[model samples]
Target: MSLVRKFMTVGGATLGSRIFGFARETLMAAALGTGPMADVFYAAFRFPNLFRRLFAEGAFNAAFVPLFSKEIEANGTDGAKRFSEEVFGVLFTVLLLITIVMELSMPLLVRFVIAPGFADDVEKSSLTVRMAMVMFPYLMCMSLTAMMSGMLNSLHHFFAAAVAPIFLNVVMIGALFYALYTGADPLTTAWYLSWGVLVAGILQLAVVYFGVIHAGMSIGLKFPRFTPNVKRLLILAVPAAITGGITQINQLIGQAIASAQEGAISALQYADRIYQLPLGVVGIAVGVVLLPELSRALKGGNLREAGNLQNRSIEFVLFLTIPAAFALWILSDEIIRVLYERGAFHAQNTAVVASILAIYGIGLPAFVLIKALQPGFYAREDTKMPMRFSAIAVTVNCALAITLFPHFGAPGIAVAEATAGWISTVLLFVTLLRRGHLAWDWALARRAALLVVAAAIMGGVLYYLRGVFAASLASGSPLLTKLGALGLLIGVSMIVYFAVAFLIGGADLGMIRRNMKRKASVEPPPPADL
Candidate 1:
């Protein structure tokens, strides 16, 4: 399949998952708001997610995909299958051990990580620690699930991996509803959410396992043994682990700082849910699909093709991301208010969350760009270069966080993160260019600049419309009126952006259409041998 279509297949599936996630977060906000319960739940959830990114998404996939793709190219199907089984056996054992250790140490982990926020409230701190313990085992299930996802992705079976997250959101939403109806206490509800996470992890694993099987790959555990390929995988994974860990550490630092300020962590999290929708759909989908394709191309000594792929992915990301960033910036408040201004969540909370959303919007494109760019290094198995650049970025993030948090509060932390993301993007781009691995095409740059101008115009129109509907939005009496106003704003923004983009030659609708058609006509890249 063509790159655009491949991206769409993955992105479309991710988009559905993100929409369900939005529903889940909305329900969660209404049920728990920015209270102690919300704080505890967010903290508990972050632990597993942080490690999952560090180990599974960052370390394992980064190492596995390229090596697995190479094995498929070099040795054929049965060889790749044997390699997979060996890797899986090792991963299973490692994760099981880590889960046990994490569960036992959950109290100490919570005390160190989230203690600043609960300094004055010992009771809440204790409850958060307990809840964290209930949730820590989720990391093991998700890590194994991620390994399965990596295997599926390598085979170009994007649907199952993409759809798995939807199941997670569905399970969480069900748990929230159950807690609401059962009249459970907030702490109990939080525990239920934690348990729901473990269940969802298992379900997601099952989904992907079947997807691999359906793709004609029979996967099963093998006796663990050290192999040359396994050693290579470990070597490649270490730098990626550090790189991914640095990014998460920056987030953990932000969380730690936010915890000191009442409701700050929850506010950051809520705004994050809003920004994450676009990030997950466009950024992650492109990154996941691009890496294996680029790796295989490079392994086959196709430098020009790999370069073309990189440029196209950049264009694809910027084309969608520029407007997404603008829309979120313009309509942050309206979106937040519409989705979350109910039950225990009040307008004041909405205002704070919206401000943070706007701040996050500033960095959205940069973050997505990093996702597109990093694969360039990873596909080449040069994880150390990106890791070095990430170390610098993380330091910059820490300094900014420390400098700004005292005066600007939560928004300051958001600004710090945004700044760090742009810095990292620039560093990655320059390094790639210096190494003669990536180059900027004039046509792409012109198109990107034009898209920015178009997005600005769209933003201006949405700003004006939002003001015109402000009174009804604030009155909050009629739900339909509020939703209608929001829908109108979104409609105008889309129309204005697309119209301006097309008219100004900022984007080629015909090219996009042709590309989509081409994507439909082509078959997927033949599955990797295993």
Candidate 2:
């Protein structure tokens, strides 16, 4: 398949999952809102998620993919399969042990991590700790899922891994609905959602396992032995793990500090979820698919192709992300109100979350670009450089959070995040240019600039139309008014953006057409001779 098609496939699946996740969050907001229950649930959920990123997605995948790709390229399929089994054995054992320990010590971990938020409120603090303990085992299941996902991605089997996360949202939403139907209290419902995470993780792992099998690969547990390849993976993974861990630690720090201020953590979490929709759809999809492709190309000395891929990835990101950022900025309040302004989520909650969402919107493109750029370094086996840059970014993030939290509260943390994101993007771009891994193609530059301009036009049109519709709808029609206003605004903005983008040559619609016309233009070379 062409790069665009591959991205669409993965991104389309991810988009489904994100939409379902939105529904899940919406239900949670209606049930719990931004009160103590919401705080405890968000805190509990974040604890396991932080570790999942640190161990599974962050450290292991970065190191494992390149090595696994190399083995498949050099030693063939059987050799790569062997390598996978050994690594899985050790990883499984280690994660199982860690989960037991974490489950046992969940209270202490929560106390240290989110203590400031619960400083005086002993009841909420204790609840958060207990909930976190209930959810801690999710880390083990998701870690294994990540390992399976990496294996499937290496074989270009992106569908199962991409689609597996949808189950998470599905299960969680079902559990929440069940709790509500059963007349459970809000805290009881939150606890059920926490346990649902463990269930979802298990389902995700099973889905990916079957996907691997259908793709003609077998993975199983075997005696754990440290081969030279495993040793190299560990060596590479340690630093990468630290890098990933530190980035999460930075977020944790922000969350911890924000917790001290009432509702700041929950506010930050809501804003983050809004921004994450686009980030997951565009940036992460590109990163996941591009990294292994780039690694394979670089290993084969195809620097020109690698550069072209990098350029295309950047173009693709700009095509989607620029418009998304503008839309989020313009429709921040509408988006928040539509999705989360029901039940306990009041008008004041919407206003505060919308403010943070707009701030994050300004940095959405930067965050996505960071994902696109980092793979260039990772594919070349230079994990340390990105780690160093990440350290600088984290330091900036921490200092800004500390300095701003005293004055702006939760919004201050949002500002700090945006600032850190831009700083990291700048550093990554400069390094890529200096190292000659990427260059400024004037065509790509012109197209990106035009995309921004078109998005601005869309934003302006939507802003004006929202006012017109607001005035047209009377005060008594609250539900219809909000829905009508949002629908008209989105419909007009989309039409304008797409029409302008096509007219101004902001996106390569023609290239996409050609790619579709010639379906077999670039076939895989017989699975790398394995």
Candidate 3:
């Protein structure tokens, strides 16, 4: 399949999952608002979610997928499955031990890592510990689920793994609905949500587990053993984990700082959910497909092919990311009011969240660009370099957030995160070029400049439309009316952006269409060393 189609397959599924995630967030906003319960629940949830990314998707999947792909190329399906079985045995044992330790240490973990702000309020701190314990087991389930996803992606089976997240959102939505129907207290509803997370983890694992089975690949467990390959995976994964851990540490810093102010953490979480839509669709989808493809290209000594692939993926990301960043910035308040300013969530909360969203939007492109660029390093098995860059980012984030949060609050932390993202992205780009691996040609550079120009034009139009719809977005207006106005602003801005992009020669719809129709004569590749 072509790169465009591969991205679409993953992006389409991600889009569905994000839509469901929106529904879930909307319900949670209505149910818990920016109240104490919402803060506690979100704080607890962030712990396991952090680990799920750091270990599963961040380190394990990154290391395992490349190695597994190489194994398949060197041997075949049977060899890959055997390797997976060995890895699985080790993965399960480690996860089981971690889960037990976390559950047992929930109170201490909550005290230090999750909610230092709740230190004065014993009741709140206790509730947070309980929620964390309930959600802790999710890490184990999702870790295995991520391995299944890596296995499927390596085999060119994107649909099942990509779609599995829908189950998670669906389960949470159902739990919220139950809480609403029963008129449960916000604290009780939080308990419901925590349980929902655990159940969804199981469902997510099951969905991908069945896909692995259907692929005619088996990865059954045996006694834990660290073979040479497993040890290599561990070495690769450790540096990658530190790299991934930097982002989580930044998040924890933000959350800890935000926790000092009641409702700030919840506010930040809501904004994150909004920005994640485009990030998930473009950045994540492209990164997922790009890594293995680049790995294979480089392995086979197809330097030009790898360079072209990198350029095209960057183009795809910028075309989507730039406009998204502009729209989110211009319509931040309207979008927030329309999507979340009802029930217990009020206009004041909307203002705070919107401010954070706009700041986050400014860095959206960098976030997406980092996703496209990192695979260049990962594909070459250069984990240590990215780890060093990430360390720099973490330093920037920690320093700025700590220094600024006292005066600027959550938006300050948002600024810190965005600043750190650009730092990381620029470092990655410079490293790639200095290493003679990848750099922009003049033609690509010109188009990237044009994309920014086109996005700016769209931003101007959106600013005017925002003024026109100002009254409709007023808090006293009906929700349906606000929704209609916000939708019109977004839809029209999209049209304007695309038209201007084409006229300025920044993009070609016809070229994209042709590319979509064209297929590469290769399947998703196995590892190069293989």
Candidate 4:
């Protein structure tokens, strides 16, 4: 597939997953609300999900993908298969051991690591511990799934791996429906969601495994062995893992701080669901597809090509993310009201969540820019710098969150997190610039400036339109009217932004159209014999 095609495939799948995620989260809000149960269930879910992201999505994949991609390019499919199987066996054994230990120590883990705020309430604490134990095995399942995804991504099979996350949303939504129909109590509902997470993990792993096997790559377990290759993988993976886990680690820190305030955890989560729509689709799609492409360019000694690739990736991230950040910042309240201010969710809950969502918007561009820039390090097997950047950012987050939390509550956590994100982004940019790995040409710089101006114009238009529709978006308005008003604002804002951008030469439909077709128009070279 062409690069743009690969990105769109993954982006399209992620957009699907995010839509399902909205459904799942909306149902969660209706069923649980911003109550103790909502806090408890999200807290329990966060524990296992933390490790799942750390091991699977964050560290291992960063370490694994480049190596796997290199293996594919160097030794063909057979060599890559041998390497993958060895890593899988060792990974499975280690994960199994960790899961057993954590499951056995569930209460202590929950008390100290996951959610200490719950310890004051015996009922809540016990429930969280139980649910955490039931869900802890998901770490093992998802870690395996991550490895499979890396393997498939290396083989250029992006669709199956990217779409796998929809499994979690689907299963969780179904569980919520079952809870509603059965008239389950809050704690019972939490149990259903917890088990749904584990089931989803297992199913997602199976889905990716099927993709690998169907590709005629049979991967059977071997005895755990740290071959030279395995040792090298670990050496690279450890820091990359830490670097990859920064976002989750900071999130855990935020939750730990938020847990002290009743309903604060749920507020953050509800806002996060909305924030992930842009970050997951545009930012993640670019980040994932760029690494392998950069690795190939650098490996072939194509520095100019790598520079151009990085430039385009950054442009794409900002092109999409900047406008999203502006809209999220401007219309967070209306968006929250239209989507979530119903059922068990109240106007007060919408206020807090909207504020947090707006704060998160401040970091949106930085978050995606970090994603775009980090591949400069990862593709070079220089994961340690990103780890250092993460370390600094996490320290900043903890310090700021603690200092700010006393008066501001959840918004304090959001502010701290966004600040830390910018710090990391700045550190990455400086490092890349110092190494002469990335630079901005005048056209790139000019366009970026113009895009910011266009976003401001769009934001102004949104504010004006919002005032005109203020009555329709009021708390007591009918759901359909609120939805229609919000939809109208969004449509007009997008139209204004693109039209202004095109007129000002910040963006060109012609260029985008050409770029999209550029990949499809080129014919592939015929395969060669060795």
Candidate 5:
């Protein structure tokens, strides 16, 4: 299959997950709002979620896939299977120890690392500690699931790993439905959500485990050993972990800082969920598919193919994300009001969340671009450089969040995250170019500039339409009226952007068909040493 086809396959599954994630967040808004319980739950959840990103999605896959692909190419399927089992044994053992330690230290973590702002509030801190303990085990399940996902992606089996996330949203949505049906209090509902997260992790792991098996790769358990391959993995993974989870690390810091305010943490989270749809679908699909493909291209000694893959992935990401960013920024208020301005989620909360969402929109392409760019280094087993760049980004994020949060509140944190993302993206791009690893695709550069213009044009249309449908999007409007208005706005914006993009030579069916029909364009073989 073509690169674009693989991206779509993974992206389509991710779209399902993101859609369910929207449902889950909507239910959560109605049930929890920005109340104390909402703050407690989100704060608790961010800790485990941060670790999950670092270990499962970020570090493991970045380090594992390339190495695993090399093993397959050099030593065949048996060699890869043995290597997987070795890593799994070590990973499982380490996770067990970490979970035990974390559960024991949950209170101290909440008081210090997770939410120092909750320290003075005895009740909130205690609740956060308990809830965090319940959810922290989720890190173990998800990390294991990530390992299996790496295996699946290497084997060109993208569906299961991509689809597995849907269960997390589905199970949580089910929990929310139950809480709503029972009219449970926020505290009880928060409890339900925490347990729901744990259950979902297990289910997700099971899903991917079966997927690995179906792909004809059976990995059996073994005792932990510090084998040479495992040692090499650790060397690569330690840095990749930091680089991979840079966004999460920044968000965790923001969460800690935001926890000082009453509703800041919850507000940032709601806004984050809004923008994550595009980021997850476009950014993640590109990252997941591009990394392994680049690894294979490089392994086969095809430099030009690797360069084309990088350029096209960036092109694909920008083509989708630029317009998405504009739509979100323009429709932020309307989207928040239509989705969350009911029950406990008041109009005041909508205003705050919408502003944050708009700022997040500004950074969407940067965030996704980081995804498209990072594989250039990871595919070559060069994890340390990205890790150094991530440190700079994180430092920038910390400084900005501290300076801005006091002045502008939650939206300030959004600004910091976006700025940091763009900085990291530029660093990666420039470094890759300087190292002669990434070639400048002038066609991609020109089209990206045009796509931005198309998005700006669409943004103007959305701005006018929002005023036209202001009444329908108002808090007092009926739910159906709000839904219809928002749907029409989105539908019209998509049409306008795509039409403008195609007509103005930004992108066309020809470009897309070429991408979808393209295969690895192999050039000269590498030197024997390489």
Candidate 6:
């Protein structure tokens, strides 16, 4: 399959997951709104998610895939399986220890790290602690799941790993539906959601575990030994972990700050969920496929192929994400209202969330670009530079969020996050260019500039159409009417963006076809003769 097709396979699955995520969040908005319970639940949930992103997904995606691919190249499937077993054993043992410690320290973690804002609110803080303890073990399940996913991706089995996340959204949606049907109060609903998260984690792990088995790898437990290879993996992973989860780390910090205000955490989270659709679909798909593809290309010493991969990936990101960013920015109010302004979610909540969503839109491209660019360093096993960049970005985020939150409220932190994102992206792109790892493509540059113009045109059209359709999107509108109006706005925006882009020579269908048809030279060659 072509590289673009591989991306589509993963992206398509992610789109499904994100769609389910929208449903889950919509139900959540109706059930909990931006109330205290919403704040408590999201705050508790973000802690385990932070660790999963910071450790499991980040470390394994940046470190394990490359190493596993090398193992396949040098020693074949048998050797790769052995390596996976060793890593799995060690990962399992360590995760168990971490979970135990975190559970015991739940109170301090909730009071200080997760939501210091909740510290004074005895009820909120206590609920956050209890719920966090319930969900923290999810970290262990998902970490193990990430390792298996890395194995599957290295073996060129992308569907299983890519599809696994849908289960989490599905299970949670089920929980939400059950809660609503029973007319459960927000506190009871929050507890149900916490347990649902843990259950979903287990289900996700099972799905990927079977996927690994089906992909012709039967990994098993072994004694947890820090072999020379394991030690090397850690050396690479420790830095990659920090570099990979920079966004999450920044958001966790923002969450801590946002927690100081009631409903701020949930508002940020609602806005986050809206933008995450594009980020998850485009950014995540690129990161997952690019790292392994780049690793194989570099390992085979195909510098030209590696450069083409990087350039084309950026082109793809710009083409999709720029328009998406514009749509999110221009249609934020309509989108939020259509999706969440129902039940307990008020128009006032919609206004705040929409403002935050618009700022996130400004950073969406940068966020996706960061994902596209990082694989350049990770494929070469140069993780520390990105870690250093992450530190700078986090520091910038912290400083700005602190300075702005007192005056601007929740949207202030969104600005900080967006500014930090662009800064991080520039650092990654420039470093890669200076090192001659990322070649400047005139085509990419021209198209990126034009794509922005096309997106601007789309944004203008959306701005006008939104005003025309104002009554349909207003709070008192029927659910179907709101959905129809929002869908029409989005559909028209897509048509305008694509037509304008193609007409202006910003994007070419021919180029897209070629990319989809282009065969990648990144597949592992046969094992070297022993």
User: Which stretches of candidate 1 lie above 4 Å from their native place?
Assistant: 245-247, 509-530
Per-model TM-score on C-alpha atoms: 0.95, 0.93, 0.96, 0.96, 0.99, 0.98
Question: Which lDDT tens digits does candidate 2 get at residues 261-378?
Answer: 7777778888888888999898878888888888888877777778877887888888888988899898888788877888778889988999999989998998899878888887
lDDT of 1 by residue, 12-73 (tens): 99999999989998888888899877887787788888888888888866888898888888
Output the TM-score of candidate 3.
Answer: 0.96
Per-prediction CA RMSD (Å): 3.5, 3.4, 2.5, 3.2, 1.1, 2.2
lDDT of 5 by residue, 1-530 (tens): 99899999999999999999989999999999999999999999999999998888888778999999999999999999999999999999999999999999999999999899999999999999999999999999999999999999999999999999999999999999999999999999999999999999999999999999999999898999999999999999999999999999999999999999999999999999989999999999999999999999999989989998998888888889999988888899999998888889998999999999999999999999999999999999999999999999999999999999999999999999999999999999999999999887788788889999999999999999889999988888899989999999999999999999999989988789768887667898956774
The clash number for model 3 is: 0
Candidates by lDDT, descending order: 5, 6, 3, 4, 1, 2
In model 4, the number of clashes is: 1
Question: Cα miss at 135, model 6 (Å)?
Answer: 0.3
Candidates 4 and 6: which is better by TM-score?
A: 6
Residue clash pairs of candidate 6: none
Q: How close is candidate 1 to the true structure, as a TM-score?
A: 0.95
C-alpha lDDT score of every prediction, in listed order: 0.84, 0.82, 0.89, 0.88, 0.94, 0.93
Tens digit per residue, CA lDDT, model 6, 490-509: 89999999999999999998
* lDDT computed for candidate 6: 0.93
In TM-score terms, candidate 4 sits at 0.96
lDDT of 6 at 496: 97
Record all residue pairs in model 1 with backbone atoms less than 3 Å apart, i.e. clashing: 117-259
